[model samples]
Target chain A: MTLIVWTYIVYIALSVPLTVWVAHTLHQNGRVFLIDSFHHNEQLADSVNHLLVVGFYLINIGYVALALKEGIAPADLRQVLETISRKIGVVMLVLGAMHFFNIFLFSRMRRRALLQRVPPPVPPQAHVPVATQ
Target chain B: MNHLYVLFDAQCELCVRCRNWLAKQPTFVPLSFIALQSTKAERRFPGIDALKPSEQLLVISNEGSVYRGAHAWIMCLWALQNYREYAQRLAHPILLPFARIVCELLSRNRFFLSRALFKQEAQSVARLLAAHCRPPQTLCSNSRASV
Candidate 1:
């Protein structure tokens, strides 16, 4: 009915689907990384991946909702466009940051898991044969 | 390796304390601690005395590989769950020498460090508790009798 209402409508329409798309992309690609991190346990990897996506969605959508009424009510089409663009820009930045944070977390997990398989860094000084305990 | 055997100086309070602490930690690989002077250590590794095990850290894998000194300390950490990353970081070529120096420093002055860090505080705490928390003579006698 009003420019402000149109701005809200456009903002929600843009933000929700954008969030979903980014989430879907991450879920598909991050599966492999997660599997490796969990040492090829697909069931555990998928469970963790789903949990991470759910958390990501909750945080991003919650941010979008809370940030909805942040600025002055739009009075014109230009104001509506500006408000929507600013809101969408913030959402995209949040998404980008979350994506990178997720990558960082999974990489750390993979590094630790791989460390478990690594050989002792230094060679032993001597070998002593012994009876089994 | 599935298991590690750590030989520590039982005579040194700090080494024994460290052994106790290491024993209590959650580990990826199981650890067995043996006193360097213990007959078990002697039986398991005859001539272990010749290696001067009391002077340096010693670690034995289940497969019979012996890691001495700095490498032994790193192997000990590698067996632990939380310290494994630290062990790996310290094992880097650049850091290994530094780690060795640190381990040697701790090992060489362990008795002095133990006196400074553990014994003095423990004695102070005991003195404070003794002064502040004296039991009634009757209760003390009753407790002793129960024991």
Candidate 2:
């Protein structure tokens, strides 16, 4: 393999992990993301979103550089395009599946937190004790 | 039954309030909220030393070992998530050790963080509970049949 080819391979390798990390980080801090998207806590969530996007670009740009170096096609451009299309399709499907799973997980946590949380006891004055006199 | 059982200061109005909130959750199963401060608690389960009972300890009861602290909460959080299978794995024999370590660290800090806010909160809860719960008990003739 040529030096450029090795560099390209390295790029792909680097890209995969970075992609995974960005997704994980985005997920780890996802409450903020959902809150922002829902307009509940837009500023804080968007700020984190922006930070993730920055990190995403840095890593994916590296991936594109690697993809560009693949040089001559595999004899059939259509075949190559088809293969690329298939992989992207799978990637998107996986992303969607994972997102829903996270959402499910998140909703459950919120429920538990809600369950575990006690509303402050109502003040005694709110409900008059029936006259015992 | 969940792998993580948060042994809390049930004597705390805030803690009790949180438990009440957890009790109202619409999950397939309810999270177990134990009041470690109750004398009944000592008689009911593991003994908690009085000096630090209020400090609150979250115990993750699993296959064989118990996890406390931050790791316990993390594992509990994992269980609280909908991926029940994955969460189960977290408590499995292989992963238990790692989760336990993480649970301990986090729990250690969480108590102090919520102490002040919850302290005042609990006072209000206790008063409300006193006003409501006592009346019901007092009126019920203290009879099992009546209750």
Candidate 3:
């Protein structure tokens, strides 16, 4: 029980900051593209970026918390280490999946915005008739 | 009858303008154009209700692939000579998402833009064609001939 408790505390401490850092990186880098997508609407872009960050926090933190319960209590040091590693590994996978999912959603939004400004293609014309010589 | 067939809204001024612009571009593969509401479109794509003639642009490649919306727009760009590189760049990981957004927005607001910007011209595409054509022939006759 003690080992499991310590592992949970350490995981929370490490994972929270890591998630925040990754989210921050995404926010900073993704802002410019979002601005361009929204036709230079900084307000809209910033709002969207903030919303995405908030969602990232909620989903990741929620996952981290929910995944804290160990299936079986660790009986020894070796068991404790194995349990902690397995938990952290799962957290890392969840984080990576969430990150990619967020990117996919943002990419879709950006695509729609960019395409809105494209001019339509020209209609085809038939060959002009030649006057009889 | 070409490598790519583009179907667009004939009544849209914006669509007409785009069609004219596309016609001017130099492309490696020939792109044939037809109005979405035309008999040709009806015959070619018999049962796909998703391709509402006036709503969105459609592109059918020689390989029998149908691309609508952003994909269709990208395919059109890929057919262009000088703009093909830009098309490829636009499809990149960093850019494709934004491109899709732009395409969707433009597709949604095309009619409004047509009315606002190209009202006069779009209202008289036939007249413009007739005047622009050297021999003073009607576009209707030419359209029939093409059909």
Candidate 4:
């Protein structure tokens, strides 16, 4: 009915779809990376992929809900659009940050697993006769 | 490598204590410890002294490659399941010189550290381990700080 209420409506409408779209994109594309990180364990990778998407939805949607009432009361239609734009911009940034954080976490896990195959960094000084134990 | 032989100076209480601790850790490659001049060490590597095992740590891979001092310490950690990443990080060119300095400092001052940290029966046992090894030195000959 009021401008602020209309702003909330528009913000939610924009944010929920953006969240779903980002989650779907990440879930589908991140599966390949997760599979590789998990060393080709598709079952495990899919499980993790689903879990990550669920968490991403929860955090982003919760943030959107919490941040809904943050800005000053909108006086006019122009002000309403401005508030909605600001709110959605913050949500997009948060999503981008979360995406980068997830990539960092998974890459660290993959690096640790891959370290098992890495050769010794330093070479030996000499050679000794192998003694039969 | 499948196995490693670590040669350490038995007379140093700190080294002996470290050997026992290393033996208990879970490792990717099994570790076998040998006192530098023990009968078994002499029999296994007749020219062990040429490598100067007493001055620093020595690790002999099952394939016969010998790693000395700081490199030997890194090899030991690399063989461990938990510390392999740490060893790799330490082996990075940026951190490697620091690792070498730390290892050399620890090796040179190990006896002093042992006297300060360990006064238990462990020192006596270590003394009995190698009769020919360097006699245990007094801690901080200049400083009067009580350990």
Give the best candidate by DockQ: 1
Over B54-82, each residue of candidate 4 has an lDDT whose tens digit, in order, gives: 78899988788999888999999998878
Query: Which lDDT value does model 3 have at B15?
Result: 73
True contacts kept of each: 0.58, 0.00, 0.00, 0.66
User: Compared with the true structure, what per-residue lDDT tens digits does model 3 show for residues A1-101?
Assistant: 48778777777787788788878988998898789878889999999999998998999889888888777767777887787777778878888888888
Location of the lowest summed lDDT over 10 successive residues in candidate 4 chain A: A109-118
In model 4, which regions exceed 4 Å deviation? A70-73, A129-133, B9-11, B16-52, B80-105, B116-147
CA displacement after TM-score superposition, residue B60 of candidate 4 (Å): 2.8
TM-score of each: 0.85, 0.32, 0.46, 0.72
Chain B TM-score, all predictions listed? 0.78, 0.46, 0.77, 0.81
Pairs with backbone N, CA or C atoms under 3 Å apart (clashes), candidate 4: none
| Candidate 3 chain B least-lDDT 10 residues | B138-147
Q: Which scores higher on lDDT, 1 or 3? A: 1
Interface RMSD of each: 1.5, 19.1, 13.3, 1.4
The segments of candidate 2 whose C-alpha lies over 4 angstroms from its true place after superposition are A1-133, B1-4, B11-18, B26-30, B48-53, B60-64, B81-147
- Tens digit per residue, CA lDDT, model 1, B4-87: 999876556677778889999988889998755445676787666666776798999888889988999999989887899888
Least accurate stretch of 10 residues (summed lDDT) in model 3 chain A?
A124-133
Better of 1 and 4 by TM-score: 1
lDDT, model 4, position A113: 63
Docking class of 2: incorrect
Scored against the true structure, residue A56 in model 1 reaches a CA lDDT of: 93
lDDT tens per residue, model 1, A9-109: 89999999999999999899999989998989999999999999999999999999998884688777888888899999999999999989988888888
The candidate that wins on TM-score is: 1
